[model samples]
Target: MVSPHVQDELRIFFTSLALGACMRETLAEWRPVVDEAIADLVPREIDTEYLESFFGEPTYAYDPDGLQRALSDPLWDLLDRGGKRWRAVLFLVFVEGFGEDPMAYLPYACIPEILHNGTIIVDDVEDGATKRRGEPALHHIYGRDVALNAGNALYFLPLKILTEDPGNLPAEQRLAAYEMLMDELNRTHLGQGMDICWHNEREVRITPAEYLEMCACKTGCLGRIVARLAAIITDQPERVERAAATYAELTAVAFQIGDDILDVENSLGRAGEFGKEFGNDVREGKKTLLVIHAIEESPPETATRLQEILEAETNTDDELAEALSIIEDAGSIEYAREHALELAADARAAVDELALDAETTDRLYTFTEFVVDRDV
Candidate 1:
């Protein structure tokens, strides 16, 4: 049984998760307006079948039940597994900071959630991850081919959502949003490429600077996109936008480092509770900041053993234990914690520079605190 305090935390996280569903419902309300606009713009009959084919072929033809079960059901189930909705909240918070009605940007808020879940579906396949949000990964249930198609399908939905202007955003703003979204997608994929390359190259030593850059591209880009879009919507000055992006980037770095720390610590079964296998990063040969620090600081024998553990085709429980011990003995865990704190502090300072209301600023600061202090 979970403690009352832990239950309370889960409740809060679920509440945030519900916000994404709420945004989806709100966007559904605008479908009629969007359909009418599309009807006016296009004269031909739109081929509905192509929608499913956009990502790839269906599992079976002339069997609606089979197709739905193979793709749509699994995709929706994965999304339903629930998340902290941090990205959506970040976008909404910035929208509020600009004095805009957040509800008016509900469709925009859904973009990040869609993109995030899509990435998770594909990432689980890439990492051979078994669980997500306390449920089996989409690929595990639906097969990798179907999961990949569904996940990639989700990637295009955001483009459709953004370009369709369900909220009746100005044409210029819509174009700008599309441009920003494209840039973010590019950065994310590039960063993922770097990560995949490093992991595959087991013998390659990664520097702290390289790891930070990867985090900026892979993790920080989402926050940067949200801030930039919010600024665009609010017609804020360039300087304010830059500050917002900087704050979000810093927050992302801190959050990712904290995540790496948790992967090593597996604190209180937090990783399992959060729907991930603990220490799988080690199994995957991830060159995390702690690993880098430990290798650079530990004794030659310890560092060599750590590398061998990472490079091994498979690691037993005892081997993983030894790797964790090396990290702790080298003080890399503490180093990561302190580094996350410093990043969070810099994020707060960046928020201070933004021309936002006091309440908005406080919310940003609170989120920064949550990034560094959250246990799960």
Candidate 2:
């Protein structure tokens, strides 16, 4: 017989494992269809490596020598540091739910993955990020120009993948899909712009509402695009659009708050650190929701100290510690955590209105939980 504590622990672990396995299976069910669709274009001789090499193009006339060096460079290796194939997975999820052939939207699925990579490349540059997936950043290893162009090269891949002669798709469907892709592209750019603006204007003061608006522009919009594009492919554009928008808003807010929390809780080496000599956000003076709320709620002396530290040209470790103390004592961390939970709950409710098939809906539900519960 097991002790009560051990039994409870085991039960929780198994439950989590089961949920993960279900999501894995749901993603797996679509792989064959995706593979077949990709195979339709890329010969069996081609693999992910060759695709990465092709993505890193040069500015000058092709010198096979220089081209080979650039292509073979390790800087582009982030392409292989795979995740859940989430964006592609979402694309196919929507396709399957609409009772459409999974193969039909495999090409469209490539759009999100490509765009996602493009953003990461540019983001690393903007953030001056040193590491990606435990490896040197592309900008760090390849230099800014190559990194920029390589990212730019990826921008066109989605078009190449998506517009690949729609073969059997009706002209109307094909046009509709392309339009959806364009809209997502525009929305994502707007979000990226907001993120960049926030990064550059480090001293800007913002309220929680303003911070949410920035997220809607910077992070939430892309997420909205992710689900809505899936709906477009599935041809359930109207019903899924609002659901996608709502999920994107909540998830984005939670994600940013979690990021700020991690900046405080985790060590700098973990990529949670935004690269300041100390608390990056504090040092750079980026206005995050937590910082704003903490200032608002702090006692007069604590607020003055935080303001002084934020305005300092440099903050020492002691200053960083003191600032964090103020933030925590002001209850900003707990506030952010509760807000994330509330938004996540709202996002879950929004999904209930969709007429998704049982398995897909369950996978989506699991995905929402995973998003909020994520540790990294």
Candidate 3:
């Protein structure tokens, strides 16, 4: 949950931007169906029927209980914590943008969504995060070994489409899907590697462009996967596919920036915010756009103090609160918010330029708005 004071500030901030009032369609039309598909894809209980259907009849003896313990339990525990599931919704929106029924291509939504939850699990481990979605992080509850295996397993689970022919694509289409998924996955890993290097070694001072490029590689990945996969499923031409993917990537980048803002917001109310404890990013010495901007723009002593706080072995509430005050004084929070708003607007404009079906384009627009607006 967002901190009360910060949530009030953000509600005022977002409201001033004239963002949409609500996103009921996401819950009414999207959430139930997307979650149901996820349940069917990633099981709570492993039965012979599920295993054989997904993996075909095993040559060796299979243990249902083993899968439930090792894979399904921790996975569901994390997923059950709750996610916006926007990646799946984005895939469906892309399908409709090409004048196809999103429901017709619904099951494929699991591809990006599961990959996303996988990344969250891995991220929490890497960040040594304590909580996710208001619960102790998976690694903290389950052993690191269990969480890691479960998280890593999520990466490969969606590939079942290739062998199982769940979507019943022609051979060529299946090969294309595999290629796109691998390409984006590789890029995301590279982004994560860059992030790790920056935070782990505080001497590194990265430029704004470098940070954005990292986001383009990491969080930006799933949107491309969702949109391009939608393009594939809908049989759209290459031009359409490229356009859809570009628009979705833009939205994802904006969403990433907004999340960094939430970390600061989390600091205001408590300790960690989004991924772990409120102000956890501050504790981790994360180099978010807010940190970067404040460092560049603040008075020398203020900036130096901020950097020192971030690079500290550990921080106190006083230090964390001071760092936030420095950022706010430098206007970095509003600066981050402005950039996020611009990106969201750019994403929406890209959709408007597409000149797709009116309703389809509207859904895309609303989704993009929802991304930046939701947290506020």
Candidate 4:
């Protein structure tokens, strides 16, 4: 466990990163907007291009198959229209702190985020998720087939970027980075597959452990790999990789758990509206930690009612209300929140073990806390 003073020191350190002279200079000309806050802090034109292109006006090659148009059209609008790019920025920040030029790793830095964005585009369709970033989903805007192709294109963007000689990184290092990236990609897809299959089949009962496992794959793995890659960029591959991976694993679980809790409470802003009907997870028989815990802790009658609600062909407002009531009565939300807090604690400890520069260590630790505690 990390000592309280150490944890507090780490927090102070990260807080300082926001206001430090170095960061101030870095942040000086850059303004923080919803779309480009992360990009603002970066020093390079290409970094900005990479960031903005994803968020702003992005056009790709033309093809009658619509592959180019579909894949290229909504990406910048979709990515730039929303999201903090916190994960990508975190990678760059840490890379800078390690005395490496962040520009050297720009290609690698944005890959995970691009992959994440790609998944979101596809997932909105798969999950029938409607709203994104406070707007209609790409599928809703462009139609499903185009939206799917657009996501596929975003998914491939990283590959092209990775193979480029942007940083002149050694072939061995590039290969290692690619391997790590592929691993994360595999996990993310696997987790998504399970999530979608569970939604469709409704036969596999979920336990908290299973939910965590899924979260680790779908969310945690990529986050961890990003951190690990940062370490690799900094040339302290082993220690940083282990530390970042540990932090990523814990934070990812906390992130997904928090998302689940938000889903239940309807507190997730645009993403909340995108929800598959209200209480659609239950209606679709998706197994989430909240539902699993609620089932375990609620009264038998409440459990039966919950199952009936889930097993029903569709969920009415009354059924949704009843399910929410049962979940509240069982204190599942509180339990889930506590679990997230615990994971945050684990993340702090994990980073503390690394022999990172004071600033990097502090920022990484603080970032984890922010993720665990973020309202949105």
TM values, all candidates:
0.79, 0.77, 0.87, 0.78
The TM-score between candidate 2 and the true structure equals: 0.77
Off by over 4 Å in 4: 1-17, 20-68, 266-285
For all candidates, the clash counts are 0, 1, 7, 2
Q: How accurate locally is residue 314 in candidate 2, as Cα lDDT from 0 to 100?
A: 82
Order of models, best TM-score first: 3, 1, 4, 2
lDDT of 3 at 107: 72
Cα lDDT listed for each candidate: 0.74, 0.65, 0.79, 0.69
Q: Residue by residue across 1-376, what tens digits does model 4's lDDT show? A: 2235433543443455655434432322221321232232222233335445444444763233343355445776676575656666677766776678664565566676777788889889987888898899889999998888878876776666556546677887777777877887888888887777766664447778878888988888878777877876566757667877888889889988887787777721223354445665555666778888988988888788887787677776667777777887899889999999999988888877776677777776666666666664
Candidate 4 structure lDDT: 0.69
Predicted model with the maximum TM-score: 3
Candidate 4 C-alpha RMSD relative to the actual structure? 8.2
- 2 versus 3: better TM-score goes to: 3
> How many clashing residue pairs are found in candidate 1?
0
What are the per-residue Cα lDDT tens digits for candidate 3 across 98-184? 877555566787889899988999899988888899899999988898898889999999877556665567888878888889899
Ranking by lDDT: 3, 1, 4, 2
- Give the runs in model 3 whose Cα sits over 4 Å from its true position: 1-21, 28-30, 265-278
